[model samples]
Target: MSLLINIQYMPYVLAAIVVILITFRLWKWKRSLNYWRDRNVSGPTPVLYFGNTLTALFKPFVYTEMEWYKKYGRIYGVYGLVRPALTVAEPALVKQILVKEFHKFRNRMPETD
Candidate 1:
């Protein structure tokens, strides 16, 4: 026995794969929504796979953070897809660093290893 394959059906296979991918993405979105709801931290409703903003159509930093500070009142929370993010309004901490001649400064993460 021999089997024959038709290239015409390839489009259907591709479409099915696309549909599956979209469905899985939606599932992850819904899961994130529920997680936020449980936390009770208020935020804007997400736009399907856009995650609360039109990041795809418009770049994330299209408008400077200063503009956001004006609208969101200097401080508001924003999420990147499924990740949680915080926008700070004021920098309450002020530390002065003085370097004389050959002083080197090292940058480190707040989470300290």
Candidate 2:
């Protein structure tokens, strides 16, 4: 009798777990969407899950980047599959990161055996 009762309630429990997972996924997606906006950065809007990758599929990557550069200016944010990427088009900032801040950005790659 106890086993039967548990089996009868299994579907409800599974449904509740599915609902919780979906809600958590949506909350995370919403947070990712606002990542750049919270930092006062501007760029093209991203779609759920895909981000801005779809734009590249429809247009040439170089042309797409150029269009974004013209629209968003030297510094803009882009999403690559839910991760936010910062593009620095300004030469001075690029030099600062590559030269003056070389020590700080030097550990970008992970060491491997």
Candidate 3:
């Protein structure tokens, strides 16, 4: 019967689905790792998947930035989880980016109550 045939192939179908999901996850991880590279920016080396999670969990962002500032200088990029963030320590450049060009860079997060 058709039902018996499907039952026999069910395990193979499930395995194929699992393989596709794993491939998608690896693709996303690779894309995230390449974000700063595409922008020609560099920061501290990231741990696979976590991406600066150790310092983010232990130290305040400002403290972490301070340490990275000393190491990588004023302009560098960091990964907060899988997302890339640029940290600009220079006051003038920060003002220009955040204030002067505020309209150009819109918020990505949805507004919440």
- By TM-score, the best candidate is 2
Minimal lDDT window, size 10, model 1: 93-102
* Model 1 residue 85 distance off true place after TM-score fit, in angstroms: 0.7
Whole-model Cα lDDT per candidate?
0.57, 0.90, 0.82
Question: Compared with the true structure, what per-residue lDDT tens digits does model 3 show for residues 15-113?
Answer: 999999999998898788778878888788776688887787887877888889999888998876777777788999978877899887686344346
Ranking the candidates on TM-score from highest down gives 2, 3, 1
Clashing pairs in 2: none
Residue-wise C-alpha lDDT for candidate 1, range 29-48, written one tens digit per residue: 77865555566644555555
What is the total number of backbone clashes in candidate 1?
Answer: 0
Which candidate, 2 or 3, would have the higher TM-score against the true structure? 2
Give stretches of model 1 more than 4 Å off.
1-28, 34-45, 56-64, 93-113
Residue 14 of candidate 3: its Cα lDDT? 100
* Worst window of 10 by summed lDDT in candidate 3: 104-113
Per-candidate clash tally: 0, 0, 0
TM-score of 1: 0.42
What lDDT is reached at residue 72 by model 2?
Answer: 96
Checking candidate 1 for backbone clashes, the offending pairs are none
